[model samples]
Target: MSATRSAPVFAINHMVTPALRPQAFFQLARSLGLQDVEIRNDLAGNAIVDGTPAADIRAQAAETGVKIATINALQRFNEWTPEREKEAIELADYARDAGAAALVLVPVNDGTGRQDGERQNNLRKALTALLPVLNERGLKGFVEPLGFEICSLRSKREAVEAIEAIGGQDTFRIVHDTFHHHLAGEPELFPQWTGLVHISGVTDVAVSIGDMRDSHRVLVNAQDRLGNIAQIRKLLAEGYTGLFSFEPFAEEVHQLENPAAALSQSIVLIKSQLQA
Candidate 1:
């Protein structure tokens, strides 16, 4: 249980404050003494989704000394279609322009896409189509499989297999999301194939995994029932030398008036646990 000097790198996602503007978000990362950060394309009023200029985002990163670890996603990425292709092209363009290192790829979670053995076929097709988009942008695709029962892609093993099937191993990687992993109840950890790890904790003792939702997500602490510290320990032990980005989606977290202070506290808590 001893902490190593090589504790996983910490990063924060904009979901920590979905309402925070670009520069303000970057400054919050800095205030927490974090150099790595992830931006989102899903926040309704925010720049990336709201059509804010990429140069403006790049400038904000430069000014704040915070590196853009990733853009939080191209949603439902596994269910490829003409519209999905267009969305991928546009989002990849933005990621490239913004100097973000990678794009998070979230598969469809609506409980319908992966039925009757069509799941693997859909996954391979998506990866095949996405390979060139990411390669052309010199960006990495982080395929994140959700753990929900209805999610099209639930297993990291399945994601890795599909990535290999499409020869996307060189340009794509898996996002080892802690919350999803707990829900998936998988026993293995694939550190080598992981590009990023999204960390969040759920403390609602009354909720079952089947009923858990993003609104239940919150920063990891002693109250965490999801085993964040142990899961992180397993990843690091498995040779995962990537960014551990905080990605709490609770509305209460997003509504925090002093997000910097809150994040700083969470950072200290995780660090202390890692060292224990």
Candidate 2:
């Protein structure tokens, strides 16, 4: 077997809409020396061409030489009924044809009065219903546990349990988000089940973890990066061989003069810290 590399591969979501085109996105990643990218389908104007012909996305990826590592998300999948489930299946097909390796699934946050047992049962049902579609399409489902109080799954531990219960680990994996991990008060080594890790920093003056919000998320080197370095180091030490994608959703980062430069700098900082 080949020796494992310590340097983490990096990618960025299409968050800086007006500033970066798909071509420019690839060029920037190439300049920064990255080989993979995760495209966010919700970014205004620069949304990954999902509903359009897959050939368009294929051409862009081919022209840019950047493989589509994963598609940003298929939200609220856990609560999806048959109609919604069918739609998600179609989306999975689209992702595969677009040359994506996986689809990220975010649990539903619908404020229902279901008990904890009901919630877990719903999650299990959803996974059982969707796993066949994902497996058939040769696509992996990256289940991301959101940390917001209202969000259903708040940690990779919960996601792992659900995956184990649903028996989808063969076709589903976890996505560890630094921002979510901090907000959820989850440990860094929780990345053991991770297939993809999202890197973002959180800044808040609150004394406790519950006070942090997703809006506080910024680039990796921001002030609230308490365990960013150590967490990534631990993941590396544990033999994680996946891409670390930048997923800052803050308005400030979206308005930056050169988002790619900021991302490049963040990658360099992460590399230096990890090497040390």
Candidate 3:
């Protein structure tokens, strides 16, 4: 892929305030000259449901030229019971109509401290059940294996295994997150699974992976990149041809005096780093 061929898509999760209206979010992306945005469903006031009429989202996309790269998440879909399964299917349909290219699925962080075998088995079952729904919708299911110590699936290896077990490699792909990859203590794991990348940086290692919340994520730079550039280089070298989205979750970014300028600067910085 050319340096700009796989132009990075950015997520509004780091820039838009949850309280802001969707129109304002798209406008922000437009001002940044961004053509893609990832929408997180659980953000307060941003709970996008099936009831959220499609016309509104479609209009925003049309006006801004910002396409929905992926719906933020369908959490623990791997462990959903029959009732939850229906709810997820409804959300998948909503995402399709909203013009989203994929649904990002984060594995369940079941707090009960189950044994490793049991957790893996539940994950396989969940992915198996969710695959057909995704296939029917023609939507890619981007599985994001979070790396917090408590998270059930912490690496791409496990995600690949789960997808393979469920025969979902055709419809499902991995979401390689820089922050999560660093937290997972696996710096060079991207080559095995080529898919979407969620990029961000963290500064503090003293902060335990479990204790470090999303607020700590920031843009990549020498002072605080936490090896994100190295990670991206590895992915590019490995022939990844998918989107790389900035998904910082920091309140500082959202509260910036000029978010568009910040986003533009961040994108430039990312481009420079990738080219370097």
Candidate 4:
């Protein structure tokens, strides 16, 4: 591997510290030596969902000098509806004002939108609807296909095709989530088309891959069964130099008394694996 392709750049998502205030999350990112971070709107009672002013988020991020990579996502993004359009517009505006680099677009994972002939139409409609909104705000739309069987969009291949079909390669990019990718059993990596990579690991020896859920996610380590290191190595070796945002969803990670130390240890382990 080339020296330039050695270790990936690291980032953290608000999910890692779902309980922290937005300002504190920014401070945490800076203190961890991570230059980039992602925020979320789903955290109950949090700033975004609670309607904290976007100006506040922007100011806090500026003070900490940590770039807000994205808002965790616009859930069920592909199921276009008047409500979803309104939601997208609201998020796009926030993303613009908050200085967020992109707006993550997560597909419908409710197990209801995958019916015959509905999936493709929903995806195309969502992309077409979102292209202009993101373009207007000068924000990239990071479309993430969940790996779950019920997820309407399960493959990056399909996401990329939809993006291309809509001539949205410039306005939209795929989020190659390591955990989701493994879950979906994807055989190919769209390294060049990927704009972000969410990293998490599953270390439970007894948990089967099919039974894995976000709650099972935790920081990467020697016991990780998700092949995070290997997947990262594939992306880096293919010249995908983008943010690797930590997104462990397990309660253990969220409840950690010193998440910073635990995060640093995971980062060290991942980096060492890449260099090796």
Task: Score residue 171 of candidate 4 by CA lDDT.
Answer: 88
TM-score of 3: 0.88
Off by over 4 Å in 3: 1-17, 47-51, 204-210
> How should the candidates be ordered by lDDT, best one leading?
4, 1, 2, 3
Best-performing candidate as measured by TM-score: 4
Measured by lDDT, the strongest candidate is: 4
| Each model's Cα RMSD | 2.2, 2.4, 2.8, 1.5
Residue 249, model 4: lDDT of 97
What local lDDT score does residue 120 receive in model 3, on the 0 to 100 scale? Answer: 77
Candidate 2's error at 13, in angstroms?
A: 1.6
- What is the Å distance of residue 60 in model 2 from its true position? 0.6
Residue 89, model 3: Cα distance from true site in angstroms: 1.0
Per-residue lDDT of 1-276 in model 3, one digit per residue for the tens? 334233444555523455556777777877876677787777654647324576678777778788888888888765669986987887798888888888988876755434688777877888888888988898998888887777777778877888898788788888888888877786556554656888777776677666776789876655564677777777776667677777777777667777677667777877787776
Provide the TM-score for each candidate, comma-separated.
Answer: 0.96, 0.91, 0.88, 0.97
- Give the alpha-carbon lDDT of every model: 0.89, 0.76, 0.74, 0.91
Expressed as tens digits, the lDDT of each residue in 67-124 for candidate 2 is 9888878878888687878778777877888888999988876556246887788778
Q: Model 1 scores what on Cα lDDT?
A: 0.89
Shift of residue 229 alpha carbon in model 1, Å: 0.5
**Model 3, residue 217: what's the lDDT?**
86
